[model samples]
Target: MNNASSSTPLGAARGIDPDLIAGIIIVLGAGALLTRTSDMPGMTALLPVTMLSALIVLGLLMIGRCLLRRRRRGDPEATAPAPLKVFDNARRFFGIVVAIAAYVAGVALLGFYTTTAVMIPVVAWCFGYRSLKGVLLADLIFTGGIAIIFVVLMGQELPTEFFLR
Candidate 1:
């Protein structure tokens, strides 16, 4: 049924709101995270659980806003949902999957820091980032930040496998 012809039991028309759809999706994802993390031991689960809970709250707010907007607009009936452009090309999506798989393999052989540094530029290039200087700078900054987080802040004992081993 179209927007104008359909109406809820209370006579309010059912209109599809993008905000409400996105909010529902986010809430589902956050709920999944919450479910997975709730069973984990120690403080490892604490951060993710807290973050997911906040995400759920934000999603609900989005949904509430969408409902409010629809109510204020005074919809005539049910509206069709907007199309979500997720994958324009199947090959491109498959290629990205391959790239991620290669990234995982590369990490085992080349180490986390090296693989990440290389992967960032390749992924950026694949996504149409043509500026060499900008890509390099971004790659450097991103890799450096990750290195600092893993090596300095977390104190993870990760060594360069390809160079050292």
Candidate 2:
């Protein structure tokens, strides 16, 4: 049956809204995680639960916005969705995946801070961020901030450099 041509019981046209689909998926995934985290003892589950709840809220907002937009348009199926552009830059996408894989490996070999410091700027440049000063500043601030968060605030030890291990 061509549900796209049919009107929903709510009087909205039945058409695929990728954003709505994504939102539903996000909400479901977050809810699932929230349930799993509910088993964690004491305050250990606090952060994950809070974050997951926020994610669910954001996903619901996305769904609501999509529904409202569809209602305002009155006829959603009149125009087909634009073609997904993810594959249009297939090389860049795959390159990033590979780079991330390499970054993960590098973390074990070079330690988290060292690997992250190098990867951030390199990845930024590869993505066509041409400002050298900006990239350097961003890399420093990001790496340093994370280092401070994990090592200082959290009192967690960073992975030791391979040679230092």
Candidate 3:
């Protein structure tokens, strides 16, 4: 009898590989720590401090779970299958590039709020968010929050074009 259920599935479909996730988390944590430790001007220190602390804590927790699993199972051979190469990952990166390009191109013409507001939904849709309601919700949340932060709190001048004005 083929023990399909008993056999652990390989690859991305098998869900997140604990070891790989832990390794990534550890690397990210270390990088964040290094960045935080480095001398930077003004508020940059806050960015790294918050990011690094969160990353280190999360990484340690993940690593701890993996170690516990290893000890309990006692199966040194328990290995996750290799991940699949997906265009989605590449597409997401490309989407970010597209957003940046669009932002730069549209800054003077479309203005910050308009360009960013449009980009968020468009990018969300490109990244597999199908529902219009969900896209709108995300776009509103992101754009509104950014607007409040930069324009309201920080008092930064956003490009308010003819359309927005």
Candidate 4:
């Protein structure tokens, strides 16, 4: 009798491997940390370093949890359950990376407001926000609130497009 439970095939046709996903997360997080550490200490550098460290720690914790769960269950394979369908998680993470890249690129070219305006809505939609109105509303609230606090109230100088002069 085959007493072992079959491994859950989570959209294997999409060619997603859990180990690969973990590895990618580890690599990207490490790269971010390295890049940030090489730069002068500033708000920009500090933020990325902090975020990278958090991501690395979170990934490690998740991997450890999967290992522990597998051991506790006495599964012979000891493979962790895939929390997200491989392709979906891949797409989600990639989207986030792309958005971050876009933001960085846009800051100098398009200015803060324009970049953030597009990024906020795009990211929300990527995370399964189906309603266009809801996404737009969320973006407007977030962007507008930040503008009010930083630009109007705090008197901070935000980046502006050259053409606006």
Candidate 5:
């Protein structure tokens, strides 16, 4: 196969844009998040609900951008796909999904801060991050952000481990 064909990412060969597919998936997940949180009191769920709402908006924007790009198909740059680094991006995507499932389930047992702090680095690795510093930085930034938002701002207590309690 020529370089062009080899460079094409997954789903493009069948006329599907992987980005568009991801956007649809993200939107659906966001909708599920909203549905799950709907019954919670607004005061208790304010931050999570707000974050999910933003995710939905971003997902819609992604979908719209993909549609617009497809409509304006004349540009060569737009037509070309990114280089195929992975044999199938699906494996990486699946890994992320599994990791997320575990993280969510872990939160109840491990508590929010600890689960989040640990999961951030694991999820970053699932996304192909290799640098130690990069992963550590991501963990720090995200953990700090969550602490500030949920702990300091919202004044919500994260569940503590049995020993820590």
Candidate 6:
């Protein structure tokens, strides 16, 4: 076996684009959400359906971009496969997914604001952030934005914090 052939990235050799996979996954997720929201009352369903539709559109755009790039490069037919880096660390990827699941569960138990405030800093730290000030600032800004969007702008009631009750 040639050394160069052995060194080829798995995705490149397989003619698989990670972005294309991601786009298809996103579209499928959005489609699932759309189906789940279909039976909701008209006013309640409007926002979710609209957002899901937008998600689908964005996913389609990603897929289109990938296809265009492949066409331009004459992928599969081309002599050289473009090296692509997928997940650098599978552990970190799975860790983030677990963190997100925890975050979702925390939202129900601790309330949205409280859970989010804690999650932001913790996630930031896990991602190798060392600046305490930066993490705190990010936490504040994100929570504030959520508050402004859901409470002030949309006049939507968020999950009540236990202490605030």
Q: What are the lDDT figures for the candidates, one per model?
A: 0.76, 0.79, 0.67, 0.67, 0.75, 0.84
List CA RMSD, all candidates.
5.7, 5.5, 6.9, 5.9, 5.1, 3.3
Candidate 2: lDDT of 144? 88
| Candidate 1 to truth, TM | 0.56
Query: For residues 93-133, what per-residue lDDT tens digits would candidate 1 score against the true structure?
Result: 79898999999899899987898889988988998999999
lDDT of 1 at 87: 53
* Poorest lDDT segment (10 consecutive residues) of candidate 4: 5-14
Backbone clashes under 3 angstroms, per model: 2, 0, 0, 0, 0, 0
After the best TM-score superposition of candidate 4, give how far the Cα of residue 164 lies from its true spot, in angstroms.
Answer: 4.2
Which of candidates 1 and 2 reaches a greater TM-score? Answer: 2
User: What lDDT, from 0 to 1, does candidate 4 have?
Assistant: 0.67
Count backbone clashes in candidate 4.
0
Candidate number with greatest TM-score: 6
Q: Please give, for residues 76-116, the per-residue lDDT of candidate 4 as tens digits.
A: 44544444455656766787778889889998898888889
Pairs with backbone N, CA or C atoms under 3 Å apart (clashes), candidate 6: none
The residue pairs in collision within model 2 are none
Native-structure RMSD, model 5: 5.1
In candidate 5, how many Å is residue 159 off?
Answer: 3.5
Model 6's number of clashes is 0
lDDT per residue as tens, model 2, 106-163: 9999998889989988898888899999999999999989878767776666788777
Clashing pairs in 4: none
lDDT of 3 by residue, 1-165 (tens): 355544543323344444646567686857756665667655545545666777777777776766565454444466544443434377666868777888788877888888888877777777678999988888899889978976677666668865657
What lDDT tens digits, residue by residue, belong to model 5 across residues 23-131?
9988999999888887877777887798899998999998898877666453455564543233377777687778879987888787777888888777767667889
Ranking by TM-score: 6, 5, 2, 1, 4, 3
The C-alpha TM-scores of every prediction are: 0.56, 0.63, 0.50, 0.55, 0.68, 0.78
Lowest summed lDDT across 10 adjacent residues in model 1 is found at: 4-13
Which model is ahead, 1 or 6, in terms of TM-score? Answer: 6
Runs in model 1 lying further than 4 Å from the true structure: 1-78, 81-86
